[model samples]
Target chain A: EAGVTQSPTHLIKTRGQQATLRCSPISGHTSVYWYQQALGLGLQFLLWYDEGEERNRGNFPPRFSGRQFPNYSSELNVNALELEDSALYLCASSRRGNLNYGYTFGSGTRLTVV
Target chain B: QKEVEQDPGPLSVPEGAIVSLNCTYSNSAFQYFMWYRQYSRKGPELLMYTYSSGNKEDGRFTAQVDKSSKYISLFIRDSQPSDSATYLCAMNGVGYGQNFVFGPGTRLSVLP
Candidate 1:
């Protein structure tokens, strides 16, 4: 089966600008999650979406937001970006009602903020 | 203290050697444990998962969980150069809406 897919493998943006990352879940998955991996800082959860609704989010600021579509795909938006926002943004998907099975992750989008 | 603690080792070992990695968590509520391997600049792939305190083996990898001590371990036998990567331990409570907590990864390198 094809795995989760993320778009724009690499992105470059400047501080104060806005950036958007996209993710398409596996064919039958219904839950999508976003995570940020920065140098020195390990993987940090960003947001969780299930059946097109935002279920939960991490400690990140409001500027970091995202939405899931009807097809179970997701998009992450980071507004007023800062240098510290530069990191590898990973997207994962899992079947609803089965959290025991770990998520399947995409390679991730590398965002570089200058 | 953080929910999970792990040694961020840049451990180097020769091929065919045994490798051991571990993580300790403070939250007793966490019931599901997992080990993920991530190559540089790549996403993490699940290596082993256990629902409760016990041990599970897959090929050359073995995962052990000890709920009493809130500790977990991953052992790789006869390691290969292809096993070089960062290993991360994750866990979460059994309740709904509970999210997975991941440890700062430990980097491992196996030499030929």
Candidate 2:
């Protein structure tokens, strides 16, 4: 099994610019989730997508948005990025309608806003 | 108050010592509890998962969940240096697309 995979392991972006992070879920997984892990803040939920639909989102602002493709891959986009957006963005995946097994997480994209 | 609470300890222990990590959650609706081990720069890997209450054992690791007390625990026996990492506790309810609440994580270091 390939597990979850994320692209652009490290990214640096200027303040006020936009950033895009990508994720590919494991084979046979249909649900994708995005989270932000800031220093000492733990994991903050960002968004959740299932079967190509945005199921729910966290308390994040509208600037933090993302979409899941038909293939179950996901892309997180941050517009008007602030220095606070520089935390590591993680993606996780799980089988459809399954929560007992827990989600499989990717290594995450380290986004640095300068 | 946060949904889940854990002591953010950078606990140091001997290589062969027994390690105990714990988390307390404010939400009694959370039925599934889990433990994840994460390296400094890597993503978290699920170590154990337990439903409702009771204990589950896997080799050198054990996960205990007490729904009545809203507390959960992870025990590592004969800890090795390779076990040095941050341990995270998470839980969620029966919803299909619900987000699993996570703790701040406890950093563990097994000294050789």
Candidate 3:
């Protein structure tokens, strides 16, 4: 089966600008989760969306927000970006109740904020 | 302390050598344990997943979880240079704590 797919493999944005990252889950998956992997810092959970609703989020600021589309795709929006915001943003999708082996992830979108 | 902690080892080992990686977690409620291998600039690929405590083996890789000690381990046998990458340990609880928590990752380098 085709794995998760993400758009704009690389992005370069200015400080204070906005960054938008997109993700398409597997064909039958319905839950999408966003994670930021900055240098030195590991996978920091950003947001979790299930069935078109935001289920949970990490300790990140409100500027880091996202939504899941009807088709189970997701978009992450980072507003007022800062240098530290530069990182690889990954999106994973899982079957609603099958959280075990369903966390199929995409390669990720590398965001570079100057 | 972080929920999950691992040694960020840039460990170098010759090919054919056995490799061992470990992680400790602060939360005892986590029942799902996983090991992920990630290459540079790439996303992580899940290597093993075990529920609760026990050992699960897949080819050259093995995953062991010890809930009493809140520790887990991954062992790679007859390692090759292709085995070189960052290994991350992740966990999740049932119901309210289903979110996956990850470690800082341990970088392994298998020299040819």
- All models: lDDT? 0.93, 0.94, 0.92
Estimate, for each residue in B1-112, the C-alpha lDDT of model 1 and write its tens digit: 9888898999999999999999999988898898999998789998998998999999999999999999999999999999999999989885526478899989999999
The parts of candidate 3 lying over 4 Å away from their true place are B95-97
Worst 10 residues of 3 chain B by lDDT: B92-101
What value does the lDDT take at residue B22 in candidate 2?
97
> Native contacts recovered, in order, as a fraction for each?
0.57, 0.78, 0.57
lDDT, candidate 3, B43-110, per-residue tens: 89899999999999999999999999999999999999999999999999955444799999999999
| Candidate achieving the largest DockQ | 2
Task: State residue B110's C-alpha deviation in candidate 3, in Å.
Answer: 0.5
**lDDT per residue (tens digit) for residues A12-31 in model 1:** 99999999999999999999
**Residue B60 in model 1: lDDT:** 99
DockQ score, prediction 1 = 0.72
List the candidates ranked by lDDT, beginning with the highest: 2, 1, 3
Model 3 residue A55 lDDT? Answer: 94
List residue ranges in candidate 1 displaced over 4 A: B95-98
The CAPRI-style docking tier of model 3 reads: medium
Model 1 clash tally, residue pairs: 0
